[model samples]
Target chain A: MTYCVALKLDRGLVMMSDTRTNAGLDNISTFRKMHVWEKPGERVLTLMTAGNLATTQAVISILDERMKAPEEREPSIFAAPSMFQVARIVADTLREVIGRQADSGQKADAAFNATVLLGGQIAGGPVRLFLIYPEGNFIEASDDTPFFQIGETKYGRPILVRAFERTMSFEAAVKLLVVSFDSTIKANLSVGMPLDVALYEEGSLSLGTPWRMEANDAYYRTISEGWGDALKQAFDRLPDMELPTSG
Target chain B: MTYCVALKLDRGLVMMSDTRTNAGLDNISTFRKMHVWEKPGERVLTLMTAGNLATTQAVISILDERMKAPEEREPSIFAAPSMFQVARIVADTLREVIGRQADSGQKADAAFNATVLLGGQIAGGPVRLFLIYPEGNFIEASDDTPFFQIGETKYGRPILVRAFERTMSFEAAVKLLVVSFDSTIKANLSVGMPLDVALYEEGSLSLGTPWRMEANDAYYRTISEGWGDALKQAFDRLPDMELPTSG
Candidate 1:
């Protein structure tokens, strides 16, 4: 169980993901879900994964290895002609990983399935964001639908739907993601702390250092507690309903 | 495809249910999901249904018949001595309906399952709320869990978790319910307008005339729009995060 979200804003892309992975309630572990492959001045690519840990790790490892050994593996993550091609490569990697799991005698089921959020840019292409499915298919975010959420998405969606703006500053975008993730972490045990975040400013063609937010981060605490107080006050501001007097 | 929620507060019980039902995305219809049987000054029982419409309607019909013909039908709903017994009767009725469908040679599936939320006072018994499953079992709300939401519950849950209070006034409770329902309606096509609501004040031993809120209802509009603005204001109040300087 994981919660990963990416927004394709007018300025660039903002992505965040929880680090918790669990085989069962008692068997929980923390693993980085956000993976980055940057080419400095040429391109920047970010991937956030959710689903079977083995499948995601395998997909990431394959992508990483392909980037380093482009002579051996064609269409490397670093060599994708555009963001769409990158999404296609990531989707194929996910399906390839799941296929390997099935070939290893595991029954055909969703056990090896993985979903990935891919967002980045190349030197010539415009910034793009996509949600890649386990089946090697993907959907790009556009003006009407500017964000994608995977895994435990519902708990945090209302806030995003109400607050997200394509023109908002990176600071506000990060703050919104924090509030969204905070709501999810509080509601679901599967999505825990120490969130991994990446900010890609359009046209920069470079990825900045990713930020990690821990459970005890003062800013996270402020937003968590402040949001609660704000919500209560907001509830109070709604006009009261007139109760029916008779049956 | 419905959304019904009930809250057990210090004052009494506040329940709300959307009126939408659907056989498929193309075959949507409106049907009342909230039902009430009140013996003025003696007892009040409010039930909200979600899931298979046939199963729910059958269960409601059986309960309605048993109440009117107590001499012919043993363990009539009105004859139940306690709220727990009332829940038992409702749960059993639900299973009976599903069992009948199974006996008709239909493949056993969730197609015939229905979940119910029941809440009210039975004179001497304290005001109680319950969530009855299709398998003839139910769980009562406690101090820790003072609310029950069935069908398309996730989108509306965060607000309830953060804002609900046991001692909140009926005005606040109803306002909270409206916000919750509004969120669900926006997120799910299966849950629509013309919501049915019931208010049971403890010691009254009677249910008031259930209110019907339409899509064009003025107060509903006020809250729906007000909530969006309030949330935006709340998000703006949260302190901004300092972006990482380098990779």
Candidate 2:
């Protein structure tokens, strides 16, 4: 299990992913789930994946191979004309990789499966965020639901539901996201840290410097401490029930 | 969908359940999920059900019928020797009702489909809480995990993970529970008001007067407002990312 979130805010795009993977509780391991493909000022695309780690890594490796063999691929992530076309390129690459893996006579239950949070900006268009499903189909974030979450999503859903908005400042958005991730991390052992967070300004063609929040990072510490204190204070403020004297 | 939680604390027991049921998003209705059976001084039992509404209703009907036919039944909830025995009776009745309904072919899928949170105190026993699975088996709450939630549980899990403790005061437990419920309600539309809350002090054989909190209830209003504000404050206190100037 993993937890990854991407937000399409007016200021820009914010993407975060946890780095823990477990085949079972005893086989837990850390793996980077965020992959960035950058072509300087032309295009910048980031892919955060969840679901079967082998499938996701295979898909990423295939995409990287395509970028290297530029003669064979005309519409790779590096050359896509727009963000929408770039998303199409990603979906196509994922489908092909999954198909190749499935054709190897693997057991039916062991078929390749992965979902990706694709977010980036092209020089000519707006920053966009998409949640690509295992079937290679995808949905873009819209005004009503301006964010997408994949993998172990429910534990972190409350903060996003209550606080996310199109008009939120980028700073507030990132903070809310960290708090959300903190909640998820505490509740689920499958989602651990060394969080990868990327913020893209709306018009910037290149991605901003990605932040790696390590375990015991001071900012995450503040978020966790503050949240715990706030919950206690909130609990204290709620009115107590006035029970009847007779039982 | 529904959300029901019951906690076993050192001083008492706390139980709360939402009243929303939906066949689909288009077919929504309110159906109380909490049921109480008390012989006052002899025994007190509360059951909160989540899952197929028809199946839970059938189970409740069976229990009610057994009470009505006391002459034929060797032991009813009113006559059960201990809370543990009462839980077995509840689980068995649930399975029997569901089995009978399936045999009639009215709804085969509904067979033994409801999960229940059963909690109460018998005249001579300690307060006990059990989580009854659809298979008619159950697990009692222990010191490590002192609370049980039956439906739409993930959205509310973070608060409980951070706040619940074996020695929490009864007042603190109830407030923590309301905040947890508020988080779930905000995240999922399928779980809603009014909420039924029952608090039973340890060694008390009967429940204290249960409170029905409606959408506009003052205490609930405070919980919603206070919790949202508290979360935002917590978010603000988190440290901002200090990313390197160049990637």
Give me the candidate number with maximum lDDT.
1
Pairs with backbone N, CA or C atoms under 3 Å apart (clashes), candidate 1: A209-B247
Q: What CAPRI class is candidate 2?
A: acceptable
Candidate 2 lDDT, tens digit per residue, A148-221?
99999999998898778788766777778888899899888899998988877776677777878888988778
Residue pairs with backbone atoms closer than 3 Å in model 2 (clashes): none
Candidate that would win on DockQ: 1
Fraction of true contacts retained by every candidate, in order, equals 0.80, 0.53
Candidates' C-alpha lDDT: 0.90, 0.82
TM-score for candidate 1, please give it. Answer: 0.97
Q: Per-prediction TM-score, please?
A: 0.97, 0.91
Residue-level lDDT of model 1, residues B1-247, one tens digit each, is 8899999999999899999999889999999999999899889999999999989999999999888897884687798999999999899889889889978989965789999999988988899999999888999999999999999998999999999999988888889999999988888898999998888888999777888999999989999999999999988988888777432
| Ten contiguous residues with the weakest lDDT in model 2 chain B | B238-247
